[model samples]
Target chain A: MANMYNDKVMDHFMNPHNVGELEHADGIGTYGSPVCGDMMQISIQVKDDKITDAKFKTFGCGSAIASSSIATDMIIGMTIDEALELTNKQIIDELGGLPAVKVHCSVLADHAIKSAIYDYAQKTGKHYKGLEGFDPNAEEEDHHDIPEEEE
Target chain B: MRQVYLDYSATTPVKKEVLDAMLPYFSELYGNPSSLYSIAAESKDAIAAARKQVADLIGAGEKEITFTSCGTEADNWAVMGAADALKNKGNHIITTKIEHHALLHTCEFLEKHGYDVTYLDVDKEGRVAPAALEAAITDKTILISIMFINNEVGTIEPVKELAQIAKKHNILFHTDAVQALGNIAIDVKELGIDMMSMSAHKIYGPKGIGALYIRKGVRISNYLHGGAQENKKRAGTENLAGIVGFGKAAELAGNNLQAHIKHTSALRDRLIEKVQAEIDHVYINGSMKHRHPGNANLTFEFIEGEAMLLYLDMNGIAVSTGSACSSASLTPSHVLSAMDIPVERIHGTLRFTVGDMTTEEDIDYVVSTLKNVVNKLREISSVSSKKGW
Candidate 1:
């Protein structure tokens, strides 16, 4: 079976479209593992609850690299609330459906967004309402973006 | 693009002649080897002939060979059965930390059952010294199981020296020769091996069939209990077609042994030379002097192994970070860890194994692809570190 991730993902991974960290960023989130062969470090610049700028560096499978790339593209123009609502399923759908085993790559992308938001909340002393007891293994549709009864 | 397969240590494609010999058994002459009819009698003869072929490969009597479902099962039977039988003799097992999971996990299982296991450490070259084996042995040491050659780093262990030591102490020694079977020369008598495991898939026979070599007059208990097959050592109906294929493959391997070794060793050396010439901050994993002829494990610093694998796959060049069995495991290799490789480089390790079919062109292609991939990953890592998010 030919592995699915094509040149777009390979191009980004080989010469990552936005390779490097953000200086004086609003938030930064890194996920995956060097041991497991997939890692993503994402930085976000948020203004007025909307993502003004986003960039990423991922070390992983082609689909993982592409998923992170496509994810940053999807979230850059959206509100923090919109990006928080992004699902791994949606990412797979967007990329023409990843192989069943490679579905974890999509999940890594979803977690990167949440991680960045959590970082933002940590830096600014605002509650990360999007990450209230987030269970990474839970089905995408079951988890809430923000808990209904936040203090 | 011409692709290369450098994972022969994982498994090999069935040889053409082995396949040809096996085709008729699966169809026209399909009959139970145990049945007492004309067709069944012919099946019995084929099974007997296969037994002789496999025995000849390792220089054992046909009665001493017990076929199993796979190498893992053979290993389990050797460890578990022997431990159970010799409970009164000793409760201690000695093995190296670099053993494949087949022996490692079984030793762990035995440990849980109150058996004392001393996991001997290896030097940076992935070789467990014979002196370590000599020191580890005690009156309570019932068995000592080490691999003939590592499936990961491909370093040939000091099995002969260890076997001689085991003999002096009268300890039953077993070697997992699954990866070493056809690629290298092996004679049970020559090495004084008491019990050894062999897998057919690794020798270009067929999958789902392997043999365990038990030296004559060595009494070990049975793992599977059923029909009086395999001299009542192992049970279940014989996989006749697989067994026959294994025999033919073994015969072919014996005939082409020297040529295959010379070709694979040269191709592997070419790959190593190319990598060393083109790359920097890389180190070979196992001992250069005592390694397998076909195995080359190199660790490229900075980049992760999985990312490198993805990049290589993109270019249609296949290799591995470790053995095929443990490829998905998130932990840095236990084998590499035992060798005390640093965490940074462990993530970057890649195993490139040559096979009978591998050529100089295949090695060059892999070298070029690897050079390109490493440079790219390193470039990204450097830029990302500087920005400091």
Candidate 2:
């Protein structure tokens, strides 16, 4: 098959940005697993309703790791509200384009950022109306050995 | 830099001798083995010799070995043929959960046909206990199919003991020894197995050809219809060139079994020791002693297998992983899951199988490359955050 990823995905995957943790983080969102197809942990440094810094650690396929890395760069320096508005499609689009199967990984990245923002809100006793329905503990149901591509 | 291949269990390059043996059957000596001519006689005789070569590797009678398209075909015939032939006797079949997809999918196929199949679980080491098999057997049990060597984990099953259990209970036994051929020794006669499947590609032979050893007097209905080829049991014209390659490869395997084992296992052992010493949170998978000497299956904690695979590939090192991200399924390996390994750990599973051509330099290079790759992935995986390292 053709190389599923474009040049931009390869670049981010080969040299991911913001790869470490903050000594003191405003919020944390972890998703996926080494066992699961994609496990990503996103840490954000929030300052006065703005995401001053963003970093991620990912355990997944090339596409997944690239998604997490690119997602972190996309959210950095953006306000918390702006980060919340970032969609998975936008994250994928920014990274050129991810394979159709790997679009879920980008979604994981977007969800992780939102989930982190939610963590910050819950801790600081602030409410974001958009995240009212969001459960920080809830995740997209574990696939449990099911294939995305059914024969 | 020369690439180092450590995925021999996946497949091997055809040996020069084997390829040379096959060339004649393809271009020059090519003839219909069944035709009534001297040229045809040569093809028929070569095929007969090939059968014996294959049979000799496993210590079976020449007639017991029936050539097939490939290992999957052999396995399919074994499971489907036994299940169909014994339907009148019983509908229940017993097999381990760690079998290749060939057997697992075939059993699932049988389930749809009103056949009952018991998918037995494996231990943490990925071995199916004979006691487990004995207990699962009942009046409805007609056949027991288990893999001699697991393709992913490299765990060697108790095929002999399991076959004996089947015999005492008057049931036929089948084993997919595709991964076992050439790498491990087998004596089907001594093991008392009713049937066993093998493939050539894994043994430095050509692909598209393999063999199934069916014990004399065992009743199995023909799998393919039409042609009178293969004793009218398996249809279609023979794959002469491929079969010829398989025979020559089998002969080499028989002659070099001990040396091959010692050489591969030494490199495998050293690689495992170095990797464990150099890396942390990495545990070797499968039986360290009972497993194939060439296989080193390991899982690096908190790093995805596919990511590690990509990095190794960049370094010109070939390896395999059980992670679903590397396959179309996008699911973890059924074999690892069947071993009851936590799903999280299963994502990092990797298999590095050495072969005859592997060298100390190659092993060292792979060790260094693996250390570099796994460390990079784990560094990115945030193992420090997970463990407060």
Candidate 3:
């Protein structure tokens, strides 16, 4: 893994932030499939429509682990609008990029965040246009192409 | 940092003695064996000697061995070639779902070429049931291909029983013994195996060389078609150095087989015992009691394999996993999928194969480091054993 991943990926993988659940959090989202053996959960505390806190649990590869770590950290103190705007590419770019095969992990991380926000909106009985028609478990083709990723 | 490589099933460093035996073949005695010069006789005789050594290891006749480029080629020739030769008798093939991609993909390719294949399923222990073997056999079944030991789970198949069944049905049986060669006892005659595949690199010989043992009177169509090499069966100039190294490795492995197995299995068991004792929600894959002496596969729950593999690599401990994160696909290993081990376990699985050179200190260091790695990953895990799969 040392040679396979960059320093940032290893750093986040080794020492992830906000690693546990937020008890009675305003919103929770879980993504990934048992068939692929990658699962992630995101729990957020919302205050004034702002994410006061966010934590995560990931059951995936280094890319997924780091993706979850950074995704949760990046969303703290962010308003629902700001959190929804965060892209998988931003997480991957911040982590110095993942192997081509592992880029899906970043997507999974993005899915977890949206799912969490969706959960928050549903509990508050308010629907966010950002999550309109978004399926947490379905694979999305909305990948932000990084020049670094080749087919 | 100390290096502890536990991926012997992937390949091994060539031994010093094998290197020494092959050096002369590379330069000093570098004559083409097909040439009719007295100098070239050295190459011919050397090849014969190597064949004898390899034959001695498998307890087969030296004349029955056909040196191949590697285990894949050996496997390719065994399945595709046998299918071609026996096309008149049958167009159906029988194999297990847990085979290496060499067999699985070759069988698949054959299927695309109008061959019918029956993929036998394994039990949780990764053993192909004899009943399944018998049931899959038909009048058009030309060959039954199964691996002696699965590469990923290290589970040993009932090759002897399967071979006997194939014999009873008058079908040829081929076992890919790539992972089983030096670690397990094999007697082709006694096992009633019609053919078997073996690689040099797995037994501390040079890479790019292997041999397929075709039992006497069993016929297979030629794979490579150029020269009249390999008794007009396989063509191309021999991999002279690799063949010599393979012979040396085979002789060394044959002579030291028991000692090698005992040493590796001892370290393997200790590693297993230590990890299980120190960790929770860890499960061993396949049948522990009926596995290769030096192999262990386990899953530390709630963690994906790539993360664990990377962490272990950082700790100077090399292991492999079922994660396809290394490849372009996110699919997990087929072997674990076939075993029906929970998907989480399959994604979290790690494979450790102790080699002849692996020592107690290496295994101990790995055990200690692994205890921490598993715990640390579990600590950061969003899901635990509590997370239902």
Candidate 4:
């Protein structure tokens, strides 16, 4: 089988370029499953409206580790708006395309980045636009069946 | 490029001799075993010969063997069939907590249908004691089903002693011996089991075929009732090619079990030794002494099994966390959890099983690769945690 990961991806997994977090990060995101054997924690530092530093810690597969490592590298110098636009497909492409079965790991990276921005926006309570990337209709569908709690 | 494969407990490569024995059945002996014509008589004789081979391997009579698609179906038939047939006598069935999902899930299914089931627990080493089993039995217990050997931790159960207890109580005994057959020498008569399941692919035989040994005078209902096949027990045109392959595999195992044990045990022990000596914070999951000669289940803390598997894949080595059936669920292995291993260690468990084809060079490559990957991941995890993000 061909190596699905590029040298950059393997390098990041073997020697991740940017790992760990700033002591006082502007935002952080943590997600994954207890059922599945994977978890991810991402943190970012924003200075002057641009992501000056970004890092991640992933408890997942080789593809998952490589995907998060490359994803953190891609967002380090970009504005929050630019970083928010990054997609799972682009992350997979950066890794030379992961196995189809493992593509979900890339999706996890995309979600982690967006989740951090969501955390930042919620904390600041500012009219942040990062929530646009997340599916809005999903919230409506999920909340429509809310039953009042029993007293 | 050479790749290392450690998932031998899932399935094995069909030996060349077994393949050759099966090829003629697919082409020249294409006639159905059920057909009464002279051409079909050859097929019938072939099946009979294969039946005798299967019986000889396990110390059962030729009449006791009935072929099924795989061990899962056989397990279902044994549990559900016995429950339905003996409903007037009893509504309770007994099995162990560490049974394969083939048996575990079937027992749970029986529960929904008003049949009560008792799932006895195994000790820390994954061994279900005969004393524990005897304690769980009651007047309403109609059947006792336990696996001969665990597929994950390689813990060999006290099947013979448990079977004797069930026999004394007049309860039917069934065992899913898919992992035990060919690896361990078995004598069904001596064990006093009423029913036992075997899968061909577990040994060096073709997939999609297995057998169940039903002792004479034990009545059970049929799962498939379409045709008068398997003596009206299991229906469908026989899987002749696969069964022939299964028989050949069993015969070969019967002839070469001693040599196979020595070869696999040597490789397994060497791998275990290397992993223990090289990897830090690592622990073996099951019994060190009382386990299948071909198995080594280890937990490397801090990192997950999926991560280890991917890194190993990059180095062309293949292993598993547990049984292939539950690999996708990501739920820390229920067996490991039952053993009271910490939650963190549960995700890190790796099951490396050896086979007749494994070589020392292959074992060396796997050990070296695993040591490198585990050290890297642990370092990475510790460094990230200390950053206080």
Candidate 5:
């Protein structure tokens, strides 16, 4: 009740764009886990060093789904380097803003794009400046697994 | 959009009668109950009458009830009070893992103070086994606190049988009956329960008011001390309006207990049946035979609970979820977790509780909306296809 989503977040959640797996995807990246209660997968189709299409599949809350939806939409038609440059803050800004607690969803989106780019780089044996020292399996910052106080 | 409320276990709307009974207390009858005057006498009489009304609902004596800020406070008083009073005798308390945080946290607090606490595991249906309880009892066990009904899964525990065990051991028994007060018929004497905690908001009464039933001769230490209020045990100026509303609600609940149960159960069963018929891979949580009449907790496989809840909210249907994403703590419901439900399934669980105001049409709308929500979420879910759901 404390974190009512803005209309933009709700819009993407209610009618998310680019939802589902992309056929012949050049790169697919999955982030988070079901155990953490939020998991997302982003599939990208690249052509001539540019992202032609982007899609997502998510098992998570409204904010996570919304973040994935907006992030996918934002990455389309951008060069691989531009797509990799997408940040969680930009995703939050694109969706107007998300709840403070749900900011991790956007962070997951950021890692998801970078992870897909990392996969793409690995597949083509191409090195990109943005891929420097990016660890896909790195733990998220302050993942809120805090248990609620008993009533 | 049609707004429908199906979260009665969380709280109920105050009834008109209860509201009407409380209105005068906020203005004309605002005198302190402790004041020595005619106006104070009116307040005193009102509180006394309310105490009797609440007492009658649970078949307890008027003198046994003490008003508190809320059910959480009552639960705190019961466990903490009993612990302090019996600390010299014993330092051990036994409670189920499925208890609401109020009791669980109180026990935890006692543990921090060097008391040895045993958190008894509940069965798959969220029912505490009497044998496990008996086995856990030790020479230092002074109190046994268990919930009468689980708030999330709606499983009703065997309070009578468990209380008998505690009585046999000569140990005090307290029940967090907040969810059971109006939903079930409770006779403290018949159940041999030494203490019970109840909330007004859960029973179609005003909030910020609850009562702890302490049976005669139960020597629990005072929860609060400042003045002679609450029979010199709890010392606070009474919540005059809230007490009146609770009393009226209790009286009405007692009078309509049978009809309320029949109506809410009918709605709950219809919702569950309809959803199961329309949706695939949906399973009810907890025991249907031994559950709160209005509660229907179901796990929708391969889909998360918060997504379904938000989708339903878009259609003007309000419900609750046990999923970690929806909770402030980011941890799934402790009640469901204690029942050994799989972590994934726990994230997929939704709790729908019908009440006096819920109607057949509302249930139908929920079922139809839920079907779409579940199907939509599953469509975008990565896990659903893997499970062939």
Candidate 6:
């Protein structure tokens, strides 16, 4: 069962690059729920339209925690538009790959990124193309969009 | 890295004595028990001795035991066979909500086949009330099946009282005693249990071997059909080596029952006491007084179970969890849920079962490792911070 996740996922889980909260951050986004067994909170510090720092605290399994860890590491130096374009697929690819049931963990990471950007947009009265049709409130349903396949 | 095995309820390592007893059957004594030859007679005699050994452990007659593939098969045979045999008399079956999936799924299958099943609820400690079993019974109720000891939480049900209620109603009573076989003393006659399911592996015997005990005069349909094995009820070639191993294991267990229980219970108590003393917001899941000696189910307040299990695994310690993330179905344990544990708490539950292999040093290592793991997990857990723990 340890082989369910690749070395990268285990590495990220064991030694997460960015963890804890970014105090007085520009934006904060929390995705997933306790009821569903995976919850993540991603905080970002944005400066001049680029993310200066990003950190996360996750309440989830290995994959979810690894996804959040890697997602934070990926979006730290990117501009808001570049961060918005960061997909769950990129996170999965970066982490080698997750089990099919755990693909939703990457999806949660993607949503957490966008939701944080949305919160930043709302705070700064700024809007971007990626923000179109993005509803942070729909996170509960969005994480469930990935069909949970039995392993 | 230190390796400590504390998941004995999941399965135990086969004892050296059992393995030595089984070695000959795989080579020299390998013969079809049904064949009318000297070699076959040896095989047949070994099976008979094994049957008696198993029966002796349970205070049952040799004729009452029927070997099956595993405990699941024994449970399947008991519930499905009885439902089919008693269908003419009734279609209703009574069972507890905390049964192992072998019995619960069998009851579900029976439900699909036009049987009405009443899933009696368990108390917060995972105990099924005899009154609830009595209330669920109807004129059409033909059978009542309950687990002797719950697999997840280690709660031992009031089987004797529940069986008495079934006997009063003239309904057949069955108990899945897979976890109870070597851990506790059992007398089918004393308990009024008409049928009981058992597995070998849980008692330090080989896997892939199980048995069902049918009290005399209780008629049930056959589960398998082929050769005339197992008194023509379960049909299949015998697992000779496995049966021999089971016989040896049962004999050893019977001889050392008190010592095994004392050793395992001491280790379990030490582990629990240390964890409770060192950890905060940890709750034991089942009744302390009425549980299997080796079993301890603990719920860590703010962290999920799989994460802790993985950490423990990395430390070379083995354990089990009732968390949804660890389960194939992506749902928390039904047994914990049925016991009225909060859904979030169910995700945090872990089961540690000690056995003959466990030691005081192993228990200390587990407690220390668990403290570090729980503290580390809680450090990053949002739930823990939210609860301000």
Give the alpha carbon lDDT tens digit for every residue of B1-389 in model 5.
Answer: 89999999999999999999999999999999999999999999999999999999999999999999999999999999999999999999999888888888888888899999999998899998999999999999999999999999999999999999999999999999999998999999999999999999999999999999999999899888899999997999999999999999999999999999999999999999999899998889999999999999999988888888889888898899999888766788888889888888888999999999999999999998899899999888767746542
**TM-score, every prediction:** 0.84, 0.95, 0.94, 0.84, 0.96, 0.97
- Candidate 6, pairs of clashing residues: none
Better of 2 and 6 by DockQ: 6
Candidate 4: count the clashes.
Answer: 1
Put down candidate 6 lDDT per residue, B1-389, tens digits, no spaces: 88999999999999999999999999899999999999999999999999999999999999999989999999999999999998899999999888888888888888888999999999999999898888888999999999999988899999999999999999999999999999998989999999999999999999999999999999999989999998898899999999988988999999999999899888899989999999998999999989999999999988888888888888999999998888766777899999898878888889999999888999999999999999887776767745642
Every candidate's lDDT: 0.81, 0.86, 0.87, 0.81, 0.91, 0.89
The sequence of per-residue lDDT tens digits that candidate 5 reaches over residues A98-143 is: 8776775334788888888888889999898998999888886557
Model 1: which docking level applies? incorrect
DockQ of 4: 0.18
Q: Tell me how each candidate scores on DockQ against the true complex.
A: 0.18, 0.52, 0.48, 0.18, 0.57, 0.53
For all predictions in the order shown, the interface RMSD in Å is 11.5, 3.4, 4.7, 11.1, 2.8, 2.8
Which residue runs does candidate 4 get wrong by more than 4 Å? Answer: A1-17, A20-36, A43-46, A80-151, B323-326, B382-389
State the weakest 10-residue window (summed lDDT) of model 6 chain A. Answer: A142-151
Query: Which candidate comes out best when scored by TM-score?
Result: 6
- Runs of candidate 2 with Cα error greater than 4 angstroms are A33-37, A47-49, A105-107, A123-132, A142-151, B385-389
> Each candidate's fnat, in order?
0.21, 0.62, 0.65, 0.18, 0.65, 0.50
By lDDT rank, best first, the candidates go 5, 6, 3, 2, 1, 4
Chain B TM, cand. 1: 0.96
Model 4 chain A lDDT-worst window of ten? A136-145
Q: After superposition, which runs of candidate 1 have C-alpha atoms over 4 Å from their true positions?
A: A1-16, A20-39, A43-52, A61-64, A79-151, B323-329, B382-389
The model with the greater lDDT, 2 or 3, is 3
TM-score of decoy 5: 0.96
For candidate 2, lDDT tens digit of each residue in B1-389? 76999999989999999998899887788999989999899999999999989989999999899999999999999999998898899999999889888898899999999999999999999998899999999999998999999998889998899999999999999999999888888999899989999999999999999899999999898888988998888889899998889999999999999999999989999999999889888888888767987999998888778778877877788999988777776767888888888777787889999999899999899888888887788788855435732
| B1-389 per-residue lDDT for model 3 (tens digits) | 99999999889999999999999988789999999998799999999999999999999999899999999999999999999998988899999899998899899999999999999999999999999899998899999999999999999999999999999999999999999999999999999999999999999999999999999999899999999887887899999999999999999999999999999889999999988888888889989888998899998887778888988898888899986554445566889989988766787889999998899999889988988888888877767667555
> Which docking band does candidate 5 fall into?
medium
lDDT-superior candidate, 4 or 5:
5
Candidate 1 lDDT by residue in tens digits, A1-151: 2344555555545555665567868998877655445567789999998998888876554566667777887888898888898998887677666655466432477887888898888788876556788644444341112222211
Candidate 6, which segments miss by more than 4 Å at Cα?
A105-107, A142-151, B385-389
